[model samples]
Target: MAELPIEIALDDERATQRLGQDLALALRPGDCLALRGDLGAGKSTLARALIRCIAADPGLEVPSPTFTLVQSYDLRIPIAHFDLYRIADPDELVELGLDEALGDGAVLIEWPEHAGDALPSGRILIEIDEGPEDSRKVRLNGPDQAMQRIRRSLAIRAFLGAAGHDDADRQFLQGDASTRTYEAVTTAGGERLILMDAPKRLIGPVLRDGKRYAQIAHVAEDIRPFVAIGSFLRDNGFRAPEILARDLDTGFLLLEDLGRGGILDDQGLPVTARWEAAIDCLVALHRTDVPRHITIQDGTAHTIPPFDREAMLIEVDLYLSWYLPHKLGAEPSPRLREKFHAGWNGLIDRLENASKSLVLRDFHSPNILWQADRAGIERIGLIDFQDAMIGPAAYDVASLVQDARVAVEPVLRDRLVARYEHARRRDPDFDPVPFREALAIMECQRATKILGIFVRLKKRDGKPGYLRHLPRIEAYLRRTLAHPVLHPLHDCYTEAGITPSES
Candidate 1:
């Protein structure tokens, strides 16, 4: 069924521009937004504001395209502004490159009626009309999906406004493998903050006793886990972002901006000192006694879940469920799947005697920020830890040393592992034998799961960028399989025709 049209009242020119800014944040490439209104209905004003906001330049000159008919900006998500009032023929849309404009980026078309049926179907149509006093009424008609995004953008604007940041400018930061989106917000006073727009989303098919894949995997269904974990980290002297303002029910959070310095150098290679600091942060974190139950700001308790055997098995199943199917173009036979499961079960069984700690599931380069001016582990800023679990400390150690996003060379990888082991050995009871064995097993498990995840990210999530890391993760898997404990998994890989290259 089609969605009903939405009507918004803009009290003045400022509100009209605010709506434009909101739309700017919501736009994606290939989007066409048609503006229908009489002259002086604030169409041009809204377009100009939107273009300027997307460019992140308040003073950007967005001249009226009334005479030229079309104006293009080479900003992020390239924009084409068109005023079709002067067009003599519908075929002129081709000459004006409307198709090409939309192929590369989004387009804002004014006097769209002049183009007749030349406008693309499914384009977001906005009708601006005169209203009481100096106000304008805007009616938006579009696909239900697009309208949902528009509603979200408007809600974010309202969220900012309620936080006394009505005048703030929002710039797109990044979106990860999940449904969450982030924005870099600059307040009127020039204070910078990060906005986490994480609306609750249920993921995947109902698998196993009426639970979804995310539920079985212990993935966060809402922003509450993030709030609880971040608060716990902050209280424990970790540099997790300070929540400046929050609307937990709405899944909007305004957080203190952690600086952009990362462990990777300008050349995209790991820096030794910075990487050491990150390791130190992990060591310090593991040494602390983290409680299973954390109280959020709302006085609600969040109990951290353990990365139990079931979760591990479900995660390992990703290899059989996604990666192997993609590689072979068919699901493996039941016997092979059982062998694969048995291999992983045997490996995880060894971790039963491993040291348990707060495992930051993603502790690699992308999530670790470097704060040079600070001393000790305080120099390390933790950004992504919402999916943290109570698991083997070795799991996090392996995650870092094998850093999936970038190549952590064999020498550096070994040195880092040794560094972590050395730091933990301060306690006389700490045993290196079990820890090393657990690290190898965890590395293999993480690498195997990621092979499926990266493939799934490409095939299922429309993100092909992750595919580039497959070879590296496979190489890490091979390296770990050299350990005697993972020999059975190696044989399983060989049988499945995914024999990791001997390193």
Candidate 2:
């Protein structure tokens, strides 16, 4: 299909490099970029800039492939740079393993006319022409889908320019399991910040009451909730990252880069001191009366959603829908599904009447950072709270103690629980028994939901890595099921053959 051509003016070498960086964001493996230009038309410079941006190494040596014909980089996504100026025949392109390189990774080919019509039809074609002074006119043409991605990337570049950080160097950061991605932006003066590229979440198929699961589960669709909640946490003395600038509609944010210091040690094990500090931070947050509605700028108030019954049921249903079918090779009978639902309904009903607090749904090691320079709970930096909801206070405690990703030793879990309870007891209204029961219930619920989620991620999303954590989550389920109050849910698990022993 034909694509609408995009014309960009490169005023100098810097503009050429910036355009290369913008184009890099839209490219993926298996894509080919065909560069058509003369010897001094700045093709090599643009190719070098694109390679360095993809590699996230500004100083990477990207010598022209004029002599070698092709040079490959071991980037996060491998890329091959090809200079076809010396090719004598179209078949010579095949002799140089061009086909294999295009299959394995992205290809950037200069002087593509040397190959005649050997180039792929859908590949991006960029033509450069000499312009006034040191300027160049760059014309981009590609498939409709590729051009759409390039357009969005150009919009993101414009957003950065308006924020006065268009000249900052961007380095890719390790992203989480969600659709959101992050980059570390550093200015020329050594100032650093984080750029969050979170597109508005696409609502899934309508499930119940014409609403999708994200709506039921209180998932944040944009950056508004993060901005509001981060402000609330920072105002309450916690270390949520400050939002410097935001494009709420696009879900793009420039935020303070909370450094890499975290509660986990170098070996990825939990550090006792940091974990203790995180527990103190949670206690401090829960002790206060946090508002459900936060007033954002422009007098817009973002209201925190309640962890209602529909949401809890939809989460736990993952066990029957995904885990049971994938692991057991059979769907649960209607009787079993009804039993599971009834069992959870009772627990969630009780939880609704319990003391409510702001529950950061993922208060685990992955989201908690350590700010050692700060004192007390202030040393704990919080993140990934965009899914925050008004829920039973015990839910976040359960999330911390029985982390889905990290193994919290049983002894340490007990110690942290005791510490949290001790801190809460300072208030006369606090009671230990109900809190313990709530914790046990939440643990069981979270484990059950995660079992289904991990399986769905593997079967539906083709991400099998998450399946490795099933045993740990199953063990957590067993521990919680041992609680006398969770016996009915335990029976449901046994009946469905989802118990740890069965696995």
lDDT of 1: 0.88
Q: Name model 1 segments beyond 4 Å from true.
A: 1-4, 11-13, 57-61, 73-76, 130-135, 495-502
The candidate scoring highest on lDDT is 1
- What TM-score goes with each of the models? 0.94, 0.93
Shift in Å, residue 255, candidate 2: 0.6
**Per-residue C-alpha lDDT of model 2 across residues 239-292, encoded as one tens digit per residue:** 899888888888788889889988888898989888888889889888878897
Clashing residue pairs found in predicted model 2: none
lDDT of 1 by residue, 127-193 (tens): 9998877699999999888888888898998889999999788878888988888899999899999
Q: What overall lDDT, based on C-alpha atoms, would model 2 receive against the true structure? A: 0.85
Stretches of model 2 off by over 4 angstroms after superposition: 1-3, 92-103, 495-503
Q: What is the lDDT of every predicted structure here?
A: 0.88, 0.85
RMSD of 1: 2.1
